[model samples]
Target: MKKLRNNTALLMMTLPGLLLLIAFHYLPIGGILIAFKDFSYSGGTFLKNFENSPWVGLKNFEFFINTPDAYIITRNTILYNLVFIVLGTAVAVALAIALKELRNQRSAKVYQTFILLPYFLSWIAVSYLFFGFLSADKGLINNLIMEPLGFHPIEWYSVKAYWPYILIFANLWKYAGYNCIVYLATITGIDPDYYEAASLDGATKWQQIRHITIPSISTVITLLVLLGIGRMFFADFGLFYQVPLNSGAVFEVTNVIDTYVFRALMNSGDIGMSAAASTFQAFVGFILVLLSNFIVRKIDKEKAIF
Candidate 1:
């Protein structure tokens, strides 16, 4: 009875968060049914919208799957995310190790602050910044480098070939510092005794990091990679949309699932199709997470998220 009474206060403290989760997350789950129905906003009560909508079953999914651009969007989404996961993890881990090795605490903090600043900037702001550099007329690259080297200014916005590299670089610049903080924390928690023992055995700094530091953080790296895989189907809408300035010329390389859905919604005003696309993304993400966790469990039961 005493323990139950003591736990009652903690339960009461959690009630608000529980209510919020139900209201925001679980409540919208039923709306997923809208994907199956041909949803339309009728001029009537809110419930009437669903009631009057026609049931199209799997037609919406079939339509999306059969679309000509479906393969392109899916390929772009998966490939870009794969590149992001691999490059992001490598760069973040390297940055974390470098920061860990920095002997001057003040300089380390300054470097961290500068690197992390880009993560906080809005994508719209970054787009304009890119404009200053990539603009064909009076741009930094054209005026400072190209013109000086007797080369004509390239039309950056119209060129499809350059966007993939630009987008990857922008993603890394914005997110690497944020990701590094996680690895840095893990690195900081590592036992000092391992390094000391390695040093006593005449191991160099590179050898110690290879054997002790990286091994210690391998589980964290695995967990993070799995999480990245889970969301591989989703793309950052702003990064793909705003950064490219919605230029039609670059759509070949810049288009992804999210932007494709947005364009479809804008053109067709079909809420059902939009909902179906979202549901598809969610379902795929859920399956990937489960599959990744299963594989992780087989490899290392202790490190499996489940």
Candidate 2:
């Protein structure tokens, strides 16, 4: 009671966020029941309809588990996320280190601002920016580079082979700057005495970074990676849906579980099936976080988030 009284203002400051969390996250948890039911709006409030819905057991899960897309969407989601995690971390860390090494502080800040600007742009805007360069007929790539080189104008959207790379590049372009800023903050927080000590020992720049900087920030890196693994099942809906313009031909490559569930809901209006998919995603993500944390704890107890 004494400790609580001392931190009363701090506790009060957290009230709004705590209430929001309960309202948005905890209260809706009861709606997971809809996943197991043949949900229908008969009348009255959503709670009334939810109470009156018929139980359907695993029937709703068939949309994902028993369908042909069961493998493709799952495969795409996992693979894309794996690439994003590995490649994004590498790029972010590298950029952060490079930015930290810059002799000109003003130039570094300017570059950082430009890099992070794309991250603030909506995905809808990004799609149009991509279209400006990728449109088949009069796009800059087609008109200037392809035509000038005597090659045919490539139809970017119709081609599935190019999309994986395109999406990867787009994801990096949008997110790497924001993540770089995160890592830069971590790097900046590290004590300068470690670098000074390493320098006194005749360490090269690379050696100092390897032995001091990376080791110092390994906890932050692990935490971020673990948090990312927790969302492996959830793809960025706007990136997959808007970027490709929902081209049917490229669905084979871009169709993640999120987009697949969205399309299914749009075409069939099967709310129960959509709910089931979301529930499955959440459950799998939860299990992955636990499993990943266990592995991390085994390797290095200090690095584990829990």
Candidate 3:
């Protein structure tokens, strides 16, 4: 009782945050029931509507699975995330190492700020920026590069073939710098004694980086990769939806699970189906996190997130 009294102020400070978490995250979990029901409005209170809805079991889930485009969306979601994780991690780590090698702190700070600026911009803003470069008639790319090179201007939005590379590059530009910051923090925390000892032993800079820097941060790299694997089934809705201007021509390549669900919800007003899709995503993500953690435990017990 005396111990509780001693920490009363600190506990009071945490009360609001705890309440917010419970209200937003834990409280809404009961609404997962709507996914299993034929939810419909009956001109009543929201809770009354849910209560009146008939239970439909797995029908909603089956509808999503049996759709013709199901395979395409699932494949795109997983593949894009895999590419993002692999390429993003490599680029972020390389950038972090390069930043560490910079002798001038001011120049390094400026470069870091410039790289991180993209991450703060909304996807809506980025879509307009991309439009300025890829517009068919007046785009900078066609007017400046294609015209000067004696080539015809190509229609960017109408072409499906180029979207895969375009989406990947845009994803990297926005997110790579944020990931680099995490790696840079890990790199900064390394003890100086290891590098000093390596230098004394006549190790080249590349050798030191390969043997010392990489090894030192291997655990952090593994943790981040595992966390990424948990969300492999999810995609950034805005990136796939807004960046391509919702062009039907590019839907074959850019349509992901999230975008597909959004389109379905908008076109059909099927709340039950939308709920099922979200539940499916959440369930798959949970399983992936567990499976990935189990694999990590088998390989290295200490590195397992659990």
TM-score of each: 0.94, 0.96, 0.95
- Alpha-carbon error at 234 in model 2, in Å? 0.4
In model 2, where is the ten-residue run with the lowest total lDDT?
40-49
Model 1, span 130-191: residue lDDT tens: 99999999689999999999999999999999999999999999999999999999999998
Candidate 3 wrongly placed segments (more than 4 Å): 1-20
Tell me the deviation in Å of residue 221 in model 2.
Answer: 0.7
> Candidate 3, 133: how far from true, in Å?
0.6
> Which stretches of model 2 miss by more than 4 angstroms?
42-44
Each prediction's whole-model lDDT (CA): 0.94, 0.94, 0.94
The Cα error of candidate 2 at residue 39, in Å, is 0.6
Per-residue CA lDDT of candidate 2, range 1-306, in tens? Answer: 999999999999999999999999899898788899999766768878887888999999875688899999999999999999999999999999999999999999999999999999999999999999999997899999999999999999999999999999999999999999889999999999988988998999999889988898899899999999999999999899999999999999999999999999899888999999999999999999999999999999999999
> Is 1 or 2 the stronger prediction by TM-score?
2
* Model 1: pairs clashing at backbone N, Cα or C within 3 Å: none
What are the per-residue Cα lDDT tens digits for candidate 3 across 97-192?
Answer: 999889999999999998899999999999999999999999999999998999999899999999999999999999998899989999999998
* Lowest lDDT block of 10, candidate 1: 41-50
**Which one wins by TM-score: 1 or 3?**
3
Candidate 2, residue 266: the lDDT equals 92
